[model samples]
Target: MSDRKPINDAMDHMNGIEGYPTNVDLKSLPKPLRYFGYFFISFFVLFFITFFVLSMIL
Candidate 1:
């Protein structure tokens, strides 16, 4: 289609733009709390997976 050319040209122009920031400020929780959060989520996921598999098997 004739309309495709303008759209393609616009996309090509956007590809050359510099979008990354030179500096960033990062914040995070304490190490112990972060580890606890990770463990909690992992255990929750494993528990549900085990439950579903057992239900299907029985």
Candidate 2:
């Protein structure tokens, strides 16, 4: 019968987490550079995990 979803309740639950940094200024960067940073960090994490696994296996 209600049209509005319970999004506020879910967000309130997330906000209660310990040590969670709530104030992120994503708009400070250009759109392209933001995506580039995401891609670079993702690649770095993946490469580190793969190298660690391979080293353990060999």
Candidate 3:
């Protein structure tokens, strides 16, 4: 019994057409996760804007 990987492993790198194999597909997430991601991003942006405006006004 051999523990070594086959030579076909080298051909697997062709799957990444974007030139980067580590790219993350955020759109493929589930429904709840998409909502959570949108909420989190909007929350941070709104929070930053509110604080910035308050600081300028005060």
Candidate 4:
């Protein structure tokens, strides 16, 4: 029974998707890539403010 248990457990976890990764390790990315989240938020806020101010002036 022990021999079949491992095989059955693996089958149950399978989602049947093809050519896609099952997991990701973000820590493997470089330092700059990890800090992209902060830069993205800052850029979004700055763009929104600039657009709002321009519209108000016009």
lDDT of each: 0.68, 0.76, 0.72, 0.69
Per-residue lDDT tens digits of candidate 3, residues 7-53?
57554444333243245688888999999989999999999999999
Q: Tell me the TM-score of model 2.
A: 0.53
In terms of TM-score, the best-performing candidate is: 3
TM-score of each: 0.53, 0.53, 0.58, 0.44
Off by over 4 Å in 1: 1-27
Q: How accurate is candidate 3 locally (lDDT)?
A: 0.72
Q: Against the true structure, whose lDDT is highest?
A: 2
TM-score of 4: 0.44
The alpha-carbon lDDT assigned to residue 50 of candidate 3 equals 100
Ranking by lDDT: 2, 3, 4, 1
- Comparing candidate 3 with candidate 4, which one achieves the higher lDDT? 3
Ten consecutive residues with minimal summed lDDT in candidate 2?
Answer: 15-24
Quantify how close model 2 is to the true structure by its C-alpha RMSD in Å: 8.2
Error of 1 at 44 (Å): 0.5
Clashes per model (N, Cα, C within 3 A)? 0, 0, 0, 0
Task: In angstroms, give how far residue 47 of model 2 lies from its true place.
Answer: 0.4
Model 3 misplaced regions, further than 4 Å: 1-23
